[model samples]
Target chain A: MTLLERDPKSPLTWSGNLPVTSRYTFGLAGEKFFRAIKDEGKIIGSYCKKCDHTYVPASQFCEKCLAEVSDWVDVGTIGELHTFTVLYEGYDGARLVQPEIVAFISLGDGGLIHRLGEINLDEIYFGMPLEAVFLPEGQRQGSILDIRYFKPAG
Target chain B: MTMRKVAVIGAGMTKFVRRAQETPKELSWLATRMALESCELTLDDIEAVCMGTAPDSFDGIHMKGEYLSDGAGAWRKPYMRSYVGGGTGVFVPIQGWYHVASGMFDVVLVVAEEKMSNFYPHAQAAFLTIFDHTTERPLGPNLLWIFALEMNRYMTTYGISKEDIARVSVQHKRNAANHPCALLGDPDITVEDVLNSEVLAYPVQRYDVSPVSDGAVAIVLAAEHVAKRLTDKPVWVEGVGWNLDTAHWTNRDLVYPRYVEYAARMAYDMAGIKEPKKEIHIAEPYDPFDYKALHHLEGLQLAERGQAPQLYIDGTAARDGNMPVCPSGGLLGVGNPIAAAGLMKIAELFWQLRGEAGDRQVPGQPRRGIAQAWGDLMQVGTVVIMGR
Candidate 1:
């Protein structure tokens, strides 16, 4: 009802806050597995013996099972897109020239969500298959972006 | 042998917003004043105050309850703040029930507020604080990522899709068009619109999420004797319950909110609601995201497992449908001021149960209604069962 323009005196704002250093670093096993994807063009997951559920972007300990998840499983890079969305607006209201396609790619027993690359937004379907495409090892940053995103399989 | 019955004697709220220009104190004062006026009572009438707020960072104000006490009319009164993050709204009423149920106070003024607009640069950054500060926060993960993951898991387990989930946004926003305080109500949205919105995380788009908001809501609760003397159509507080799960969110299966189910069971048992699907005429479940509404619907036993999305698609959850939900447009349509958003749902349930919801009311005289709110690191769930 009362729309006021941005005033410095306004009680709410996010001016000085900034995420210092790297904002995308994964944890222990997550970092290792993500690096493997970048250097070896492979995906990996962690298995919890107690829960018997595998976790992607491998974790040292099962979050649900709360048990040791030391076993590692290399997930195939190829998977199907379970769901997706296209982004036209950046976080701070900046308009994007080309919408980015983000999707959840389901792996062997678990799934990982990421930005979809080299794909048309309209062409994406619920069950469409895709594969992870890695950046060159030299350019790998050990982040989710290391793989860029799951692209259409050949 | 039983505890004293309680009734909501007053209710008030401020205009919901994506970002408010006023300070948290000013916003809380606005709603607190409105509530006192509705109840024909002054600050002196409230013997105690129970405040509920979602998080400390949303407003960039820490120990927010104490910071907000003056605005909530707790200046020098016996007061305490309760939090279950998003669940704080429903949790407030439950807190009030205890105050009255314990005979500690005949009148407890319950207030909920969230000034999310305070986090200006990008609200997503607040997500970092919700994680295990020691273990999980070290990893850069946004709040949307968790919801997206949970939604992905829910969809996988239930065979649902983005279209099915978007249908909820479309329907609720359409319903919200009638709510005066709604912030994101749009009847013209298509699944394409939601799909094309900005991506915060995979399976989560800009449109699928509730907007960050600044707002406040309040309700004055009174014991049976006081309620009977004040109004004839008082809605009785039948039952209330809240529970929390393990903090390790990633450790649990995201497909279902078992904590919410357990919380609901506690409330239903106390309320004697054996068949929520049929016994309860109207319902309001938390809906921070479109999928959350469906998830909570299943959790509240309003529908069978995986059957919530189908109800949304079949016009079953519509205002005039078999089981109406989020009639106040939910958090999806109405502004989501976090704590205030959940209370807004409770307010909607109050209006519906009393047949005062105007266009948003369920088809007939809904004798029994339920309002539930979920919060925390996917851990807290609160429920309130009410009947007229």
Candidate 2:
């Protein structure tokens, strides 16, 4: 008996790409979160009283308590770096001109992932205090990029 | 090992809409919360969660089942998602039934959600990928175009006319006037209105097709003991059956959906239902298109082939009729949000069987009802028979 294997000589393969496009709404909480950043130049979070947790970037429900979080609070522009990673290449695997430092900045009970600026890679450390840098009000488009990056706080 | 009996204790759904401000996750959460509250239960009480959502392309989210897990109340618990194209809605509850019927979980939460509005221009664009890449895709076929062919075949084979099929839309739309969550409920919709509506594809008019929608639906299933504890009116899951035809739809005869009949037969056998037309008092067949309702009825053996439209003509499919079909408006009036629409039919059965379907309830107290969903290149059929 012969075992079946991939027949390299077979010409029975077809290749194609899915032709689909999409447009997304920011959602209930997302709209509020982005609007706060764009209009007020402030960071907001949805508070779940049951879990005593505040979700950064805002959300409608708390995963821990499975409770609806309607309480919105400004977590302020200040946060502390909880973790960090440096990307040396673009998403397409193209080598970048400069390394990009991305960090998870802890706010209240939750955090935001943003790029760290105005700091040297060798000096970056855990628990470093940071503050957000926003673009000019006229340029803000209710997007995450509205907050340019997180710089080291005094 | 003895199989444990499972029953639906509660069900809930969000309003069907063309566009929703809430994200897909939020929609699932809203439905899940309401389902739990209906039975005075909480996330802690649920032992397992089963999630169902059709093609991720609709929402532009990959691995959507995992993305929607926490929102479905699956945190720190056993959770799984099932997909059978559009059949996911009815299939998810069947998945939940097994969780309890297997004596593995006392209480299970089943959720089905779809956010089709995320697909730009129209959700139909996403369906373009569902076809065979070589054989069907190159022909540039959309869902409406292909279904038009099937509709033509069905009409030609049965010698049915478009006027008879238009009646199904009018009746279902009128019935939806009573459904608070329906998107296209119209009490005054007439046959002429449907016939006059803009034609999308030949033999398939705008009114003949269900609208693209976004929505979510959730149902709570519990074992006999827990269901009895939760509510006096428990709608038992009597039988569930699903079957798939060849993916190469071109090779098959479009005159009849033999797959639906096979699935219905499997369900009837397990349900101990000898005469589906007599034993099943109500039916919620997938009706994404007006003719589909009649097509599925014949497949479910509720009526003879080509004669299913007579049920609508004679008023037997009315809410107050002897054998009511799609009393909750079906997909025609309720809106077709893919997976969510299928689950909506199951939720309707749950409510109608419990006499909880307020203004839409059928008279004479319907004791048993069936809900079926069809999906994929018109290849799969999922059926569930529920009883009080």
Instruction: Give a tens-digit lDDT track for model 2, residues B311-334.
Output: 998989999998998999988898
Instruction: Write one digit per residue (lDDT tens) for candidate 2, span A45-146.
Output: 998898887777587887666788999999999998765555433322244578666665778776665677999977876678999999999999987778
Tell me the deviation in Å of residue A115 in model 1.
9.6
A-chain TM-score, model 1: 0.78
Q: In model 2 chain A, which range of ten residues has the least summed lDDT?
A: A1-10
The fnat scores of all predictions, in order, read 0.14, 0.00
TM-score of each model's chain B: 0.97, 0.99
Put down candidate 1 lDDT per residue, A1-96, tens digits, no spaces: 111236565444446543445454456776668667667777888888778877765778876656878888887889887665555445455556
lDDT scores for all predictions?
0.80, 0.85
Model 2 docking tier (incorrect/acceptable/medium/high):
incorrect
Off by over 4 Å in 2: A1-154
Question: Which consecutive 10 residues in model 2 chain B have the weakest lDDT in total?
Answer: B132-141
Reference-based TM-score, model 2: 0.72
- The lowest-lDDT stretch of 10 consecutive residues in candidate 1 chain B is B132-141
Worst 10 residues of 1 chain A by lDDT: A1-10
